[model samples]
Target: MSADIQKLGEVDRMIHEPARLMVVALLSAVKEADFQYLHRSTGLSKGNLSVHLSKLEEAGYVAIKKTFRGKYPLTICRLTERGREVLENYRKVIRAAL
Candidate 1:
């Protein structure tokens, strides 16, 4: 295989998936985001978003916090430093491959 094609293999599969990619990209643009905001922004159902968030959390790529906004519960998410590095690398790999 060509060098460019080989670079594709270095892509991070965790962030490469569409839903997680969207969540990561969104988090990259903000300090953090609430569950409802992410839900509306990504158009992902609550369950699906939860699942993806869990995976990201497990991989240490995202940080999730649960707190209360007055009386309402809030789930806030942000990408970690490692997540930022991985995402930047993923972008470079994809760009080189294409």
Candidate 2:
């Protein structure tokens, strides 16, 4: 396997968590999405989604925003530039490995 693939294999375990991976994948697919959107799409409970989102945010892969939409509080998440680079590198590693 290539060096990049080998490197990714090590990092893979970190981002490979089911919920976190889903969050990353979904956010990567879109510019940004709300908390409810992720919760609904992943079929995870609010608490569960919150926990995972916190972890991803701590890891610096995602950024969270708190705002009000028509007087209703909203939490929106977006992937960071670092996250996009990591995901792209991961894809490259996977392609090379395969």
Candidate 3:
């Protein structure tokens, strides 16, 4: 249906991408995750994951914090309220379209 197609179009492009979607979905299941954990889970190269995270951070969908863990650099990522809402909306849109 045209209306269903239109709903698909309304899905958030950011979360729609496969890589970003995987990240967001994983984040949704936890309070937060470190860069290494995400890398292992998603199997994304470090550079690719960093780039995707930067995009999400710029969009205010995710928060990234840099800190030291036992003198080691640590990057933590978490989904923001806006990110949760957008992901929820994205799911609805996809469901409706299907």
Candidate 4:
């Protein structure tokens, strides 16, 4: 009901976007996930996945590590403590809102 709460709600909404949320959810479930893994799990193309990944990385909610597996480069994503907290808060807010 307060302005601060409303602003927090807006931020929650932004990170809770369908694609971004799925990415976060998947990462939260696993220790680390590769780009192909996320692509398969979310059924999102590389470009779309990259876009959403960039957003999450930009927010510092996720950490992406780049490495090489044989001849190919791998992008492994992990959820940060900040991300977990935000997701938990988001869950609480959603339950309260509903």
lDDT of each: 0.95, 0.85, 0.94, 0.87
Q: 1-98 in candidate 4: lDDT tens per residue?
A: 75545655555764789999999988889999999999999999899999999989989899999999999999999999999999888876666555
Candidate 2 per-residue lDDT over residues 1-98, each given as its tens digit: 66865665566554678788888999999999999899999999999999989988888899999998998888999999988887777667677766
**Which one is best on TM-score?**
1
lDDT rank, highest first? 1, 3, 4, 2
- Cα error, residue 6 of model 1, in Å, equals 0.8
Specify the poorest-scoring 10-residue window by lDDT in model 3: 1-10
Summarize candidate 3's per-residue lDDT along 31-85 as a digit string, tens digits: 9999999999999999999999999999999999999889889899999999999
Every model's TM-score: 0.95, 0.85, 0.94, 0.85
| Pairs in clash, predicted candidate 2 | none
Error of 4 at 7 (Å): 9.3
Comparing 3 and 4 by lDDT, which wins?
3
**How much does candidate 2 score in TM-score?**
0.85
Clashes in predicted model 2: 0
Model 3: clashing residue pairs? none
